[model samples]
Target: MRLYLTKAALLAAASLAAQPAFAQESDDLIVVTGAPAPIAIENLPAAAVVIDVDDARVRGDISLDQALADVPGLQVPRSGPIGQQTSIFSGGFESNHTLVLFDGVRIDDPSTPESVFDAGQDTLGDARSIEIVQGPLSALYGSGALGGVVNILPRRGGEGALNPRLEIAGGSFDTLTANAGADGTLDRFRYALNAEGYTSEGYDIVPERIATHDGEKDGADITTLTGVFDYALTDSLAVDLLLRQREARVDYDPGIFGNIAENPGSEIQSDTALWRLGASWALSDALSLRLSGGALETDRVSSDFGVAGDEYHGDRDFADFSATWSITPEWTLLLGAQNEDENIEAVSFGSPVTGEQEHWGAYIATQGVLGPLDVTAAIRQDDFDGFGEEFTWRAGAAYPIGEAARLYASYGTSYRAPSLFERFVPFYGNAALDPERAETWEIGGDARFALFGQTEGLELGALYRASEIEDLIGFAGFAYGNVDRAEIAYAEARIALRPTDWLTARASYANTDAVNAATGVALARRPEESWSATLAAERGAFSGQISWRQIGSRLDTTYDDFGFWAGTAEVESYDILRASAAWAVNDEVKLYIAADNVLDETYEPVNGFAGAPASLLVGIRVTP
Candidate 1:
């Protein structure tokens, strides 16, 4: 069984690195997607990661790509199992070159064709954290941030009492889940709310193909809701509001290439909505002002059995304005303006299409601290009515190397624009595409000391990234062009440990080399090595976690025997393990248990699907 799960994950990492370390203390997190406010995380200079909500409640992660699958130059993938369709590749670009946000709006999907953003329809109840910044950010989010940016930070409420929560869960194909929430703060107003639901009965994501007899299976159902509101109106003003929604129905199976007909009643249904409004003003204490606006909508339907297949509608409206000047205390400045509009309607075979696009942007940025370094720079310009102009820039630096290390470097430029179903879909639209530029560079560092001699605390990090992608939109001889060009390089490493005071550990690694510099191939499902490890523990109220992940072999794209497009194949390598536990049957109750693919190792991340197996879950939670 893979050598007994690699000797039980090296004996649980050598018994958590041979225990015996104490004095644990932690908390040094603050991030805002690496800029535009909130900082710290070692002064953030890109290459970031956060994942809060207590790390998705100690790893019983549900969606958001299983809580970003051990982030580190991320690559999610997944085309089968739970809610199916998920993608998020970074550094190697593609998957719409990253960029996804929630609290601050923008959630791709402009009638697809690369307007990506679908982490299995995201869910982490009311989130509260999830940063992930990595590399190119289109000079502060614009176009699809070349290869990084994921925000999702919801849950907010202030002042005092009133807090409530509830949860329930069930497992193994025939899964179920439920959640509820509440938040507080009265004086000057503040609030938060959440709701969630899930259902599953999935399996047979191509169950070893058998020439298709569609034994039907492949299920999902989901629902979610979130809300937040804030108001101050004094002490320098404040106002904010947000709302979110999601709905889904999924099931699938049909093509695993060539012939293999057995539709088994395909399905897909979706709905999404988001809204935001905001205001903040300080105008002193180094000056400040902020404004925001947002909207997002998505609708979809696809069916096969009960007829009617294909229909989509998408929309987005956005606005933003910003200002900040801390012209002292080591200087800072930022300025911004943005607007976006997108619309789409699509229907299949019986034909029907509609499209719209609009964008405008302006930006400027600066940050400072000189002796011992910390610097940042930015620039942006965008205007795209018909894909006309674009400009992006970024610069970064960070240095510390003293009180427990820091060092960083960055360079960036990005762009993506080209999705209105790749420019008006009708016989495969193409209004003369353009806009797919990129350039990136990154360097990393991280350190934090005190290990073993007690006072536990350890952290280490490393990163290196490279990129090049020029006008690379694909799909030839039948529209959607800009032909191809791409190149990518990657390296990442991470470690975090706490040694005592009840365990904690983490590890990560990545090594990728994407290609396709115009047909040299190798970029399909990307994976040139990947890794992950995790362990968590808590005493006095019981808690637990264990995790492992791996992916290596890659390359996919096959289909011959009349289905055309025949070529690459190789999608081997795989490993996964998971476990979870919780108990706090006291302070308002809690109980949990979870297990997933604990060695039911059958792999296929794409290429004929089928991946997820061995599952179990049980849960309960309540708070007051």
Candidate 2:
């Protein structure tokens, strides 16, 4: 589609490459998840948000979910506290529809029944930023991206000098935590390493108000290790390596016989590791090529005192290659291919079951100035073992309004293939199920302006997006099947204020209207309305931040034990407030304290599961 194809529009877009999507907070804030390469926030016709996890230790954040609680339309739904079963609901899309990436590698689990990633279990260990790109992005990434992508970018070494850091904390609920990391650079190599561990007695997640509820507190013990190395073998070729591993033992309620959702002896122990090796080769002055290969291993076991336990093991091997041709200063072309193989096995009641899946994909894309608009177009073809072949395409354009404002729109198609566990799990599986396909379109704009006495910043951002999915997978009376179609419409309004350089404030309101086409009922666990706000300030050596969130009611279906339908359950709305304050004792040391659920409101986002309660933590850091 043409983007205001006029001579004036042409002049406007000629200098629109560097405008900020919301505000010019930093001229060097780079976002890499929106496209194949780093593109300006305003140049792409997609919606994206970047959340920084700087100094997480000083902020008393144990996991990445705490840093993401302020995101407008991204709802973190957890069955309990940290290390529990948790996922995110994005833009009213299904929980499993959101794909996650560590650096740039896919991390979706293949062993889980729904093939979903556990966002709650991932801790913020040496991460620099987290980027969220909204809408269907199947043209760039294949399955499990029907809603969007979440990429966690870690800090790298070799920038300049060597630095070392250590932190320790203890707080309410018998919690203890520690972190250590160092960054350094050598002759032609740079390296970074980080390790963190946490243990807590944990508060009880089963409320005493419910019948048959066990008052035993659920607890968690977790540890994470990260290593990154980069070597400049030559001027034209460079190699990099990444290794990450996490091990956890989490206690949870199993909702045993006659109990709403509690069991004293239920627990799970899991271990996961990821490793990747990548190299970039510049073949010529205008052409470059890149290649990477990686593998992920997962092992987990769950059980209760008197019940049968289950064990699961999964493995995934993946390889990717891409080429970039810089045709000119304003135009470029990208070609890429990806292949992945996954295998999983499970032991239930002393019976071992196994499954496998494979997929290959190739894509091409072009981007540059066209007529009066900056535009992009891409197409991809993916082949899966059971689903045969599927194709997806996307196109978008942006029109700038002089140097202060811009408008953009995009449309794309995406799909999700049936998981191996969904098709090979005993009598509950359905091998005949087909992949779910969907299309999405969005139009949004943001501007930069000055308020009070501040520099370039944003006053407002308006966005509206919609998606329609076909052949949604669901449970029938006998087995899983393609049950219904779903329609989703979302809109958000945001305002940011910078009264001065020392203080800032932001607030946003979002509405997600999603329903099933057949029954016209709202989707389960997708909140209809959400609100978020944050305020931060700095004075001398003291800094502080405050955040608040509100979520609306959600609807879900409850089922009986005999594989039969029961009734609908409504989850009520609630709000929470959190705050943090830090003080610099000197240039090499700092002290901080954080409080959660400051108002002490008691409510559950999910039925029968208790939310986190009021707690406080104090910590100290040493940097050299």
Q: Go through the candidates in order and give each one's C-alpha lDDT.
A: 0.73, 0.76
- TM-scores, all models, native as reference: 0.33, 0.92
Over 1-624, each residue of candidate 2 has an lDDT whose tens digit, in order, gives 001122111111111111101111245334231122344556666556666665554566778776666677788777677888788788999988987877767777788878778877788866766666777877777788888877676767745668788888889888988889998888788888999898998877765555545567888999999998878899888888889999998998765453456667888988899998888788887787778888999988997874548888899898888776778867777778888999989885566758888989988777888876878777889998876998988788888777767788989998888887788888778877888999999998877797787875556778899999999988988788998899999998888888888787889899999999788999988888989887888888999988888988888654333322357876678998988999999999989999989998887766566788888999988986
Off by over 4 Å in 1: 1-45, 49-64, 67-81, 84-114, 121-143, 146-171, 174-249, 252-301, 306-308, 311-389, 407-413, 420-422, 425-447, 451-502, 505-624
Specify the poorest-scoring 10-residue window by lDDT in model 1.
1-10
Tell me how far the alpha carbon of residue 304 in candidate 1 is from the true structure, in angstroms, after superposition.
3.5
TM-score of 2: 0.92
